[model samples]
Target: MSEMQSTRRGRPGYDQQGILAVAVAAFNEHGYDATSIGMLAERLGLSKSAIYHHFGSKDQILDLALDAALSGLEAVVDDPLPASAVEASAVARLEHVLRGAVHVLIAQLPAVTLLLRVRGNTEVERRALTRRRAFDRRITALVSEAQAEGALRADMDASVVARLTFGMINSIVEWYRPGGREGADRLADDVVAIALDGLRRR
Candidate 1:
């Protein structure tokens, strides 16, 4: 439906959020092109029309799911660091952003997994890909600034560091399990420690 399912319908049924969660999982597992409305409907136990009523198409669902992933990371980038961190050096700021990225990835693993799988076969995917590159550039700028300030090793290319840093963080999607014993904060801290230890100027 164009609106949420009525409260009278009971909580077992899927609403837009519930459906989108399933859609993200489906897309992540099968790839966006490999999935279909029929499969989503079957999984939700709702007809395709019900899904279409809530969303224009599978593309729309993907767009929203990817938004969920992007919003968290964007928040970390756009928001100022905590009071103590406000005057932190360039490398510290870079480390803060990078650590926050790991937290974002862990918090939104499923949506991010879907985002990382996008191949630009459709307009939605292309837009997502563009936004991703823009985010990468922002981080790369931070890397370059740290290098210029003599905070990071100048020998390595900033762009290479950006790619390798993200490559390692994003790789968590392949194996990191949510609600695990190690917890989000520890994982993010460990990632920051490992990534920055090698990057900091000796």
Candidate 2:
């Protein structure tokens, strides 16, 4: 079967955002293997060919959807640290970046969740994993700085700390809702506080 025929949809037309919204929802609900282009087209009232026009194949669609989520994360990581060394300590800079990351994770939870779930079964997923590792490395560097500056506890390995930190941050995707008792800002504060100060109250 042709790529479109196998996927059961045409290139995506209409608003790219709208199409991505529908496609991501479909992928989330049905999973990558189960979702068909026909179903997506039916949902959007378009032909399978329409989606194919927008995306070359199912994998292409998945890559674009995943990118949409990771792009938000990339934005957070790309933010510049304070220009003056005295302006903020390493820990403060780390907190700022973490807070920005929380916004990205919460705002783009669906896409990010999908992005995190990739199993490396395809080339797209493998590429996603590489990018995810790079992001983690940058965070590790910040953690190392925090340790050197005495802002963060130095007992633990920076790589280990970075892994745990991101592990906690990424977990937000699993449980976060758009509106709840705590919003993104509040959640970010709570996360940073919990990280900086242990759960035990003095």
Candidate 3:
């Protein structure tokens, strides 16, 4: 038997990846629950059954779309930071990861946004959240190490500091435009300075 179809429309033989790409865009614009296979089919100029041919259900489509969104993040999480602690100062390493994260997040904004917005209402959403939390935990450990090394303030808890840092970076999704007044590098610089250094005139 052939693979299960997601909708009544059947399937499109070529470009399942293309179909998923369109689906991700639609899911981003309308939200996963709000979007439908019909909309995806219409957008792709395929029949609903065609979409079903590729995916077994709307949730299956979401799973694939979420996978696409999270692909970048997975790489970041997997890559080891600069090996020696001294060569890769905790703070410096954290900054490097954060900068890379900004690039990845911006480059994959739709998927990253979806990853950030997951609320655990479904299995896929819950898994995305778990992965996000894992990344956060890694950052938190870096912050704690930085604090121990006297690179960051020890007053605030590492977890709290990590959340604050992510809050600052994640907010970029709301206001950052691809070619706006502030570029990604400049924004990353400003963010690092504000987060790692104080504004007091020295």
CA lDDT, every model vs. true structure:
0.86, 0.82, 0.78
Of the pair 2 and 3, which is ahead by lDDT? 2
Segments of candidate 3 deviating more than 4 angstroms: 1-14, 80-86, 199-201
Residue pairs with clashing backbones, model 3? 5-52, 6-52, 7-52, 8-49, 9-48, 9-49, 9-50, 10-49, 10-50, 11-50
10 residues in a row with least lDDT, candidate 2: 3-12
lDDT of 2 by residue, 1-202 (tens): 4322324333334555567778888888888889899999999888888777777887888898888877888877777675765467778878888899899888888898888788898999999988888888888998999999888889999999988877898899878878878899999998898888878989
Sort the candidates on lDDT, descending order.
1, 2, 3
lDDT of 3 by residue, 2-120 (tens): 43333334343336666776777788789888988888878877889877877899888777767776677667656677566547778888888778777777787766777777789
Q: Which candidate is the best by TM-score?
A: 1
**lDDT agreement of model 1 with the native:** 0.86
What is the TM-score of each predicted model, taking all chains together?
0.90, 0.87, 0.83
Off by over 4 Å in 2: 1-13, 81-87
lDDT of 1 by residue, 1-202 (tens): 4344545445447777889988988888888888999999998889999889779988899999999998888887786788988877789889889889988998899998988888888899899999899999999999999999998999998999999999999999998987677787898887887887854666
Worst 10 residues of 1 by lDDT: 2-11
Runs in model 1 lying further than 4 Å from the true structure: 1-12, 199-202
